[model samples]
Structures are given as C-alpha cells and as structure tokens.
Target: MIIPFIIIALISLMIHVMEPVKEIVLDRLNGKITYPKTFIDKEHRTIEFDSLHVYRTLTTSGDFAITGKKIFIKDRKFNYTWTLKSNECLEYWSFMVWYMDKNRPLPLGTAFNEYRLQDFERRKAEGFSKPLFPGTFHTPERTPSQHRQRKEIGGW
Candidate 1:
C-alpha cells in the first residue's frame, strides 16, 4: 500500500542524510613536506639482469628496507626476488612496483593505487597505501596544480 512506499522513502532519505561525505578529512598534524610530484630518480636506478622479460626495465631510487637482500617480485605472470638495498633505493618517497606482460615497460597496475590500510585503529584512518606499481606516476613537471599540497603525517 501507499503506507509502505512512504515508509521506505522516508527511511531511504534518512540513510542518505546519515551517509558520510564524499571527502573524508585526513587530520595529519605532522609538518612533513614531500615533493610536489612523485618522481623516481632514473639516474641512480638499475634494473636487475633478467629481472623481467614480459615486463622489462625496473628502476628505483632506493627507499625500501630490503633486509632480504632484494625484493621478491611476484605477479600473475612473473615472480622474482629483488636485491635492492635502502641505500640504493630512493630516500624520501615510498615505492610501488607492478608487473607487465610485454617485453617493454608498462604502466603500474591497479595495486599501485589500490592501497588501503585495513586497520582503523592506526594513526591515520584515511588515505590508501601506494600500490606496488601504479598505472602511472604523476610528477610536478607533468601536472602542476593537480598535487601542490604538503602531505601531513596522516595522509598526503
């Protein structure tokens, strides 16, 4: 009857009103200043020999803590451990590596951007972790105003 419709519509409205906003505030109080863009240092990077065939050319600026001597690359098509050290990696930025299926350098996959911390009790409840290989990385030179804010301790 009309009564059911009215109840349903009212319930739907209430639910919509209670739903969270489109943007969640990441309250990071730390005064950390990251680069305006995400750029990898190609000059100080090296790809492991026979590192990738379907996916060739891996580069880094040495920022990860590779205690296992190297990284372990595993994907739907390729799998290999890396021997990169923190000293050899990039300094300030975190990294995301992904595998490609061709004999050339493909863009980072979904993992690079689909990073989400499962825990809610952590310091920051918002923002996702960087994917291993993002489909593409943005740089200050590439897109200017897209990313010009200083990232805080919580999220950037």
Candidate 2:
C-alpha cells in the first residue's frame, strides 16, 4: 500500500509540473501570431540592443537565424513569435509579433525595438576583435569610449 501511494504521489507531482510545460509548448505550436524564437544558449535576464539598428536588420537576413519569440514590453508578456528566414548573422535580432488577442492596434511607430522576442541573442559569435554590424554601422564587443575614438578616427 505504501509503495503504491508513493508512486501515485510522484506521478501527480510530475503531472503538475508538466502541465505548464505542455501549455508553453502547445502555445507556440498552435498560436497563430507568434514571435521568432532564438536558439542562443546563454542565460540572461535582459537582452539589450539599439532599436533603430534592429529595425534596419529586419529588412535583411543574416547567415543564421535564432529561435526567438516576440512579446510586449509590459511585465511577463512573452506571448507571441516572429519568423526569420535562413539569412543569419552573428549579431542580429529576431522577434515575433502577437496580434491575435486584443482588438487594439499596435501603435504606429518607426521604433520596433519595444517588441522583445524571447531567447534572442547574438550569433555566429566572433572573437572579441570582431565587428557587430561589420559592413554596416556598429561593431561588436567595443566599449563606448573605444567606439567613440574609432568614430573620431573614421575607422569602420
């Protein structure tokens, strides 16, 4: 009797935990308006980058794509997913726009950085000496001061 009870309890506990896992998995697969999901392996609480720059990258695809999800800036809003093609780069942004729930329209704004796609991170990671937007405007892993000096020197 004791063994049977313990097994039942364990199963119940596992089911309780798995419910959330099931919901999250199903939400992504079934949700119509989901964000792009990135496949980065780093653990972080905040993903930061420039909004204007991200907007520019949205038009062009890099060599690789991250599996990232899109969501609102509001608290605990990792709800939607954006899609990205195979064009990927080392430093890029991928997001999903969830527009299925509310009737309210997304505010008209040139800035799209407000929409954070979960699990998004830099890719094709280069050495510390590598540039961010190499052929474009920014460089990776450079301090603000160093970037300023490079800018003054007209280095790309």
Best by TM-score: 1
Per-residue lDDT value at 146 in model 2: 38
Models 1 onward score TM values of 0.21, 0.19
Candidate 2 lDDT, 3-93, residue by residue in tens: 9999999999986765421111212222332123333313222222222112223342385565443322221344323322334432223
Q: Please give the TM-score that candidate 1 achieves against the real structure.
A: 0.21
Model 1 Cα shift for residue 143 (angstroms): 12
Which ranges in model 2 have alpha carbons more than 4 Å from their true place? 17-98, 101-104, 107-156
Query: lDDT of each structure?
Result: 0.30, 0.30
Looking at model 2, report the run of 10 residues with the lowest lDDT sum: 118-127
In candidate 2, how many clashes are counted? 27
Measured with C-alpha atoms, the lDDT of residue 147 in candidate 1 is 26
Q: Positional deviation of 77 in candidate 2, in angstroms? A: 27
